[model samples]
Target: MNLSRPLLAAAAALLTLSLAACGSSKATAPGGATAEVTVRIPDPGNSGVLALGKKDGSLDRALAAVHAKVAWTGSAGPFAPAAQELNAGQLDFALGSITSAVTALATKPSFKLFAATDPDPVGEGILVKDGSPITSIQDLVGKKVAVNQGGTGEYLLLQALAKNGIAADQVQRVYLRPDQSAPVFSSGQVDAWATWSSYAVAALADSGAHFLATGPALGSDNYSVWAVRTVFADQHPDITKALYQYLHDGDVRAKADPAAFLNVFTDAGPLAVNGRSKQISVDFGRQNGVLSPIDDTVAARFDKVAAFYAAQKITKSQVDVRPDLLDITKLPGGSR
Candidate 1:
């Protein structure tokens, strides 16, 4: 179902919170102790990154040094909703894909991207049923493809298709949530599905889908980013720094032991589908410790995304993606 323009407008309204209340803390800790920060994480699909934080005591260890308490919250919906809550001053931190962050910035420019948890954003890709004759972007002409609107999945597909000289009108676009797109794809309702990380891996395993191309093929530096409200960062700079460190540490642990990471995912909750966990375990290894620096590749990818959005008329004006919205140098350790 298409989300009504009015509903989306309302969402934009609720999503807009003033930065005036940004640095104010509701409660102060005793004896000048650091205030506790609540972190809201959208469900990791089958990643188990959240559970790992709890089990490894990484959250505790990271915050302990700063004398701050870490309150963890999770949701199963798209990252946009939780990020909206963060924009509304209900959350201190939130996890989201790079595209989600970009959308959030379009509405609320007060949030700052701090670090990247997943190394490559473009790892996500379009999956077609195995044995399908579709071997390249040109082959997708006149076929139905599913993707989440305004998401990395959609963005990557747009870029890939454009790079291959495929006209937008040549293919039918079916906007579906990542979860819904999978079943539709498996049922042959759509010729291909664009998805990322856990869901993409799950589709490959369950449906025997062949990869058209991954995000990296569209652009080398496509990667997800972790960001917090600007006020939260300004008020609690130490806590923000600690959180970045914690994410970096988690990446280290994930690299050293992926099976251990899968166990964490399984223990936290059942995978949306079985056998998907195994695939995720193998994929996470390739992504581990790959989150250190933002290079020219990332900047170039952002430019590509902005240009695509402009061409699609997704924005009324050109998006200036530097200084105002992206200040990579401000990240922990002054950017890599």
Candidate 2:
């Protein structure tokens, strides 16, 4: 994830432009700006569930109650690097995978973790076309696989293969964004695609596609957590709390009616999927889809990711994330 200076600058500029689309104005709050809390979610094309919140007004309605506001800036790469955007002031809040956050947090410890979600253990995984000769992770040797840097795809693929006796050098890992991976995997250009959530579901919809392995199989203690830039959290603690509170409420509403939620996603989503989002959303909701505040066990889980990455040498040095984790009180189920 070594971003060049020019590329980093460009990414920051793109994020800034995206934030501008979120709209800003002259206003003052107890902390500072009141116009918008610019947050970035993984922009997995139109099928992204996060986009639904922006379209259906659920996020807005939730924010309005707390006298808070949010401006979504969808980042196109690994959702993990949104933490980098947050640290760079290109984003205020971002949601990411456990592996992505822990790995990125190793380098960007300035990010603060507040809340975490218990993603379906099997929700994310390596997907391959049904008729492929590949059967086990061992078969990945000398095969091309699509993954995203700063995403679970690469991590899962690496761990799954290694466990089955394939080393990193034995396979060809093609790094592609979620959007890019879908069509590539669909066209049979790559042997497999490793991704999660709706994007994974979209790939799965190809009746010919099937799961080869999953995060759980590789001992991935995954969670989708929302984190923010430490400075922003320090300056606007109330606003941060309001955002998470709204998110918790939205989760409750989402669970109560997964189908309805999917409709909003599909209706608002620009991608023409044949009910992929619907199926993924409903099943995901039933997969212990509840969120919990940051606690010791969860924090340890994040620590494990750091250690995992270090052992894998994906990171040059070890990073301590506990110092940056903040326990925000007064969440839906109450904070730890």
Candidate 3:
């Protein structure tokens, strides 16, 4: 293959960065040069750190301990796309939902889940117009429910329906993003909406909106996972561990100062109804416990999620979440 000098240089630089990023933990890269940690951000994935980073620079201080700075990669949301970008090798580390990772892996993407957070199970919910007389999950049967296809919203709805004795095939699902879901839901375009995080909670506060059920109310303990390409993890175990610590620190700081980190999560989008920042913070803390190493409980939870996705046909391919979880032993925290 023929290559211009500039093209060759860029290729070489990429190779060097990748090697440095995935290499064993050291004061520097294989060549003694440190690589910055590239994080796909502005989503729920890294919102805690992003928010804390903005308010007091706590995330920065954590990053500095490993001598790595954060290089913002993609400025997108809902977590699904960011995970896709990471799997494609266009980005480095990513924040993703367990459902998103499972769906992607069912298709055989070279991805891995490094760490996990179980955000308040109730953080996600099935929403309806306030005072509409539909008070429980059973009411959603035959009703049009708005959800993000191939995301948490779908399975969360599925689980809710099953618990209420409403079959999955009974409800009409309107595939809508968070931005679209809120407005359409308010305008009566859909009978209900299912979503997660501060966005889901914000929608519930709408004068015309109320929750029929939440993740917990529906028997869900789904998790938000931190992931990287397997190839990347194989090469940079130390850097991978560093990232988990930094994010865990962010979660800790946010919990200690809940009022301080509210806007960070809300920054993903607007809140038509003014949100309760402190409550959101505490709830977020409750939903997502300390960032921890993946334990038997984590693996078991993921297995259930995989089986659920397969049953729901969210992923047409065979699903096995076990292979996708990357175990890092030397990390400061013993979670994974």
Clashes of each: 3, 1, 13
Candidate 2 lDDT, 1-336, residue by residue in tens = 799999999999999976653332223558774454444444534433445676777766655554456665655556555766777777877777777876777664667888898755766888989879998888888899998875678778877866776678898989887778888888889998888865776667644687888777776666788787776666556667766776776678667766654544455445554466467657766564656688898888877777767777877766677887879884222111
Better of 1 and 3 by lDDT: 3
Candidate 1, 214-258: lDDT as tens digits: 776766334566667777777556567666766766677777776
TM-score of each predicted structure versus truth: 0.80, 0.78, 0.81
Report how far residue 93 has shifted in candidate 3, in Å: 1.4
> In lDDT terms, how accurate is model 3?
0.70
Question: What is residue 223's positional error in candidate 1, in angstroms?
Answer: 1.5
- On the 0 to 100 scale, the lDDT of residue 74 in model 2 is 57
Clashing pairs in 1: 121-222, 121-223, 122-215
Predictions in order: lDDT: 0.65, 0.70, 0.70
List the candidates ranked by lDDT, beginning with the highest.
Answer: 3, 2, 1
Best of the two (1, 3) by TM-score: 3
Could you tell me the TM-score of candidate 2? Answer: 0.78
